[model samples]
Target: MSDFTQRFLFDDFDARGELVTLEGSYRHVLAKHPYPEPVAQLLGELLGAAALLIGTVKFDGLLVLQARSTGAVPLLMVECSSAGELRGIARYHAEQIGDAQSLGELMPNGDLAITIDPANGQRYQGIVALDGANLADCLSTYFATSEQLPTRFWLFADGQRACGLLLQQLPVDRQKDPEARAASWEHVVTLADTLTAEELLSLDSETLLYRLYHEEAVRLFEPRALQFRCSCSRERSARALVSLGREDADQLLAEQGGTVVIDCQFCNQRYPFDAADIAQLFAGGGVEPASDTRH
Candidate 1:
């Protein structure tokens, strides 16, 4: 399968933007979970949003977008790193779902949360009450309230494809080209809003840009590929077992017949630890597991 793709740009004036569309990669992530239509769509949107944000930010860090509800869909978490790696998982109360058709109907009081884990700086978090009728509205509200920038976002996804657009207002020197900046931002967003879901899902970066901004003078950079990658492993699980204390680990191992197994909810990958694995993990004593070192 091809990697997920991200396209980025800055207006000749002061604003910046990104357009990201994912099909095969997004479908691969969603395939692990048998989510309802609304939940599945939400997961795809979150994945697109996370990829876009990761493309925009500068860090060897992780950007996570999460939506939680006490309603039918209990939890949805999407993680994207600076390198364009993506993974997501969703949990739901199947009994409560009861044939719900949309996010609003399924999660009456959902909340959206954004977390930025920078490699060097302190972790940051932003939370917003799910105000909009959909995930896009909720995230737009988040940007307006939390970032306080004149930002606009459009996100749409079906069970098969996910797409998103992000426009952010960059602070300009108040005296120079302010009019040009405002005009450019509005002009670009206007064109972007006219985009159809099919256009977003099917077109390549260059074609999509031309379709939207052919008349205008816009700079398009080389597109970066995004990928569906699960950051889970046996070593990480064993470390988690060590954190559970020897007695607790022993109890679980005893109940499970000398092995404790953890299934990654995101990728449906299993990490199992037998007795020797536990002994090795304990012998290492405080050595953290390598989450990035995948087998």
Candidate 2:
């Protein structure tokens, strides 16, 4: 099935949810990096989480989920645009990653940061300690602590595909009994917890929702397409070089035999700059003329 995210509301309860399954886009991300099995699985989970979280907010730029630690896996990050394009990368010490399965084992002393950057506005960020056994648990902790909302997440991934389900309780209406709203939230979350990883990866959204909430009044929205796309470009790379300043850029060119090479970690695309290119960039001439060769 095509990669997509489905949003659903519980008509009879004060809650909302999102389900995301990523196949083609997930595979495309894996194709760009040779991550170890454990690391690959973690990246997949983050990718799914990024998609679900991005769908829950309104922004025109990018949403980034990052985990940093001092354990075997030092850093794992995923970026998703408002347009549904996704990309991810993980950094780890291969020797230290042998067979580590849980979040604590893979990223001990870690912290998770979620950043929301709009195309035109101030960025917002929330940082939470990685205090749970898994990525899903850590994320749930984030919502509960930062947003003061009861939220839960089920995330699973193999090297091939990634899937996630997010459930959050909406604000209770003043006229409604608070006890009843709390009960409804607990009931639905209990049902969602019974979902197996196999079913999440294999079942479509409609069938999956029916299997979990067949008795409840649920409304499912149209699926939003998710794609694998990297925001990296020749122009962005040039700006990076320009940031290095004229002296540093010239020194790098001299050290690398008159051509500086920069490779994007997200896509492995190479951007090469010679003396002419560096001069043009430092001269304030935006990214080498269109005629400039790009690889």
Candidate 3:
């Protein structure tokens, strides 16, 4: 199935939920880098988590989820835009990774960070220690500690696909009956906890929700498409070189035989700057190469 995120509201509960399944997008991220099995699985989970978290807010830019540690896997990060474009990368010691399966094992003393960068406003970031057994638990701790919200997550990823479910308790309003709302929240979460990883990965949103909340008043929103897209371009790459200052750029070009190469880690796309390209960039002109050369 295509990658998509489905939002839902509980008519009987003061809560919200999101279900996301990523197949094509997940595979696209894996294709860009040959991540080891453990790293690939972790990247997939982060990708799903980023997408689900972005849907929780109304923003116009990018949401980034990052984890850093002093372990086999030093860093793993994923970014999802408001428009559903996604990209991710992971850095790890291949031999040190071994057969570790949980977040604690992969990142011994790690910290999780979530950042929201809007197009026209200040960025917001929150950090939490990675004290949970798995990624889902780590994120749950983030929500409880950072947002002060009762949030739960079920995340699963193999090398092939990634899937996630997010459940959050909505803010209480004076008009609503507090006891009723609290009861409903508990009911929904209890049912959600029964979901198995296999069912989450294989079932569609509609079927999955029905199977879990068939008796409840659950309203599922239309699925939004999620895609694998890199925001990298020759222009952006050229601008980066210009920022290094004219003299440094020229020296680098000379050292590399009049050609400077920049590779995007997210998409594995290479941008080569020859003398003409470098000259145009330094002259405050656009990069208009004769042919598109990508490696």
TM-score of each: 0.87, 0.96, 0.94
lDDT: worst 10-residue window of model 2? 286-295
Q: How far is candidate 1 from the true structure (C-alpha RMSD, Å)?
A: 4.0
Top candidate by lDDT: 2
Q: Candidate 2, residues 182-264: lDDT per residue as tens digits? A: 88988999999999999999999999999999999899999999999998988998999988888998889999997788998
Query: What's model 1's TM-score?
Result: 0.87
By descending TM-score, how would the candidates be arranged? 2, 3, 1
Candidate 1 ranges beyond 4 A from true positions: 8-12, 173-180, 285-295
Worst 10 contiguous positions by lDDT, candidate 1: 286-295
Model 2 misplaced regions, further than 4 Å: 289-294
Which candidate should be chosen as best, given TM-score against the real structure?
2
After the best TM-score superposition of candidate 2, give how far the Cα of residue 215 lies from its true spot, in angstroms: 1.0
Model 3 C-alpha lDDT per residue in residues 137-256, reported as the tens digit of each score: 889888777757798999999889899999999888521887787787788889999999899999888899999999978899999999999999988998899999989999999999
- Give the Cα-based TM-score of candidate 2 against the true structure: 0.96
